[model samples]
Target: MSHATRTRPARTSASARRTHTELLSVYLNDHLAGATAGTDRARYLARSCRGTDLGPTLEAIAGEIAKDRRSLTDLLRRLHIPARRYKVYAGWTAEKLGRLKANGRLVRRSPLSTVVELEMLRAGVTGKIACWEALRQLAESDERLDPAVLDDLLHRGHRQLHALEELHREQTAVTFHASGPQAPTPASRGTGAR
Candidate 1:
């Protein structure tokens, strides 16, 4: 190999040399132990990285911040990146999280149908209680509704009454494959001569 090819190139201009020296000093200062640069510094680095490849620029700036000590979180914040936790509803099975429509119909599945039914029951019971109190104060009161029947109200709407009256209406989307495993057929006993 030629010695010229092996040797580092000399800076031809004093201005160019100054820039290189400054860049190197920043790198070393940030690289040193216990030297922490703030978000302002990181922003400057990201801004300086424009018009250049992001990977190399980010890497170079990251090197200046800390060779191995800086956290990705710190770096991102320094770049003025906002902290926003995305609400992803993709493929999650959490009940009441989605009300997606599909196949020209809305559908709901039971995770705790009894609990939801009970909540509705509680509301109805509360209303009934209020009415009973009012009626007792007045002259009109029904003796049939024992007012203490809230305990059994949870199971009151357990049956499919009136084709989906939908006491606590909820909905979500789901995808499923129709193809199932093929079943093996039994051998013919007559042909095989039992």
Candidate 2:
């Protein structure tokens, strides 16, 4: 082979670049949908737990999750990716439907609700962490992605996960180890009922 031929750099076709961007658009939109659900769930959980021992931490987490969703939206705009409103609406609807699950209570909030919601929030945060890590990797090649922003997001996600794990452990212990079904106190009565 000629030296020039061997030394020449390979080129990617325009179609290949378009395909890559299209795949990335799909992936990010999916994450945005999940983030929408997560934000809604976090806000709902925080409101339910208001005035409880976990209230402040949950409120903080809800705010952070909302901010993260905004960041994801901004990223989508920067990449010229359109937000799929249908996916966002589906996510919102799914979270609302999730509330109808049987939590062993009909007219009141159960301790099991806290445990289950915390578990769900933790899982969502874990997924967010994974998305941030994927973006961090992509930032190495994609000029539109900022490594600094991705790193900040990753750090916040890990912190959120740690807080959630602690809450989940405490709630699980309190919910499962009780001697029997304790009646709600007057102060607790009707507080979290939705």
Candidate 3:
């Protein structure tokens, strides 16, 4: 809202929190799913949080906007994943983030390599763990499994994070512009010289 608020930073070691922060960026962009949003980079940036770590700061920002986790997470159900700001990812441990990046778990060229797929795998892993535990409890003969609640939890973890996927498309579309070599500049095309 103000310059002072914009400059605020959360207090933690540069090394320790950077990974988590980048992880948060990955998570957020994943949550937004990278639709055109409102055509405002400022709006697309989202997360006008107060504290450090874009995650908590996002929560903080939501608070300023009169929204909390329950409210935001609720909206999360329908929103496309958000785009990760490369600058934020820059702060993380290079090796681990590189693994994440190169693995295409954060960003990638192919559809299968995107983070959403990884998160879905993670979700499936979590679901299997829970399903195993639920089966174990079922075997115990004391409790009954509610298919509805179990399905909800399973879906939460297994949900596809489409942010990176959308970002991939959005970025590829830009490559044809004057910025990247995918397209030629006016001078190179001889259009500007005439």
Candidate 4:
């Protein structure tokens, strides 16, 4: 048979195609879970930091995060991938549990809280950048994936990361370097000469 009549080596069986889709669905669902947690955390941090230097920036980033999550949901729907609700619930629960961390304050927001939360948000944004890039690669072969949309998401993720890093640094300095009360005591720093 001629090259044109060779049937293109069967073009992957339907079962194999289904498996591929299933795996992609699972991967996207995992990211969706992370997105849920990140969105919740961002909103909380924004609210906590309200009236401070980081307030407006954190609030803006939180809104962008919610928008990103929606975009991911839309992509899943377009690809006919059903989101696993349990994973999303787990994400939400995890964010809630994160608040229980001891930050040297029992009744009020610790300075440490802002620093740590910004770091976590930064990490989430980094992951989101990776996710968008991965989907962008798939867009080359999958008509359901949109390269332009993925590119826009990637751009926003980078912007988010930069903003988070700035907030993290500012909060870190305030939390770790102040002298009024939150500063580390000399004994807490150990008696050894330095």
Q: In candidate 2, what residue range of length 10 has the lowest lDDT sum?
A: 6-15
Q: lDDT per residue, candidate 4, 1-194, as tens digits?
A: 68756655555566688789999988999999999999999999999999999999999999999999999999999999999999999999999999999789999888888888888899999998999999999999999988999999999999999988888888888777856567567777776678
RMSD value for candidate 1: 31.2
lDDT (tens digit, per residue) of candidate 3 on 99-147 = 3434333443433333333343233234333543443343354234344
Give the residue spans of candidate 4 off by over 4 A: 1-12, 180-194
lDDT per residue as tens, model 2, 1-194: 68667555434456678898899888888888899999999999999999998999999999999999999999999889999999899889989999998699998999899899999999999999998998899899889999999999999999999999999888888788959798898989889958
Worst lDDT 10-window in candidate 1: 87-96
All candidates in order of lDDT, best leading:
2, 4, 3, 1
Among all windows of 10 consecutive residues in model 4, the one with the lowest summed lDDT is: 4-13
Q: Candidate 1's residue-wise lDDT over 113-149, tens digit each?
A: 3223323333433333333343233223434233343
TM-score of each: 0.18, 0.85, 0.22, 0.87
Error of 2 at 141 (Å): 1.7
TM-score, cand. 2:
0.85
Model 1 lDDT on a 0 to 1 scale: 0.32
| Poorest stretch of ten by lDDT in candidate 3 | 35-44
Better of 2 and 3 by lDDT: 2
* Candidate 4: residue pairs that collide: none
Candidate 1, residue 115: the lDDT equals: 27
RMSD of each: 31.2, 8.7, 20.2, 4.0
Best first by TM-score, ranked: 4, 2, 3, 1
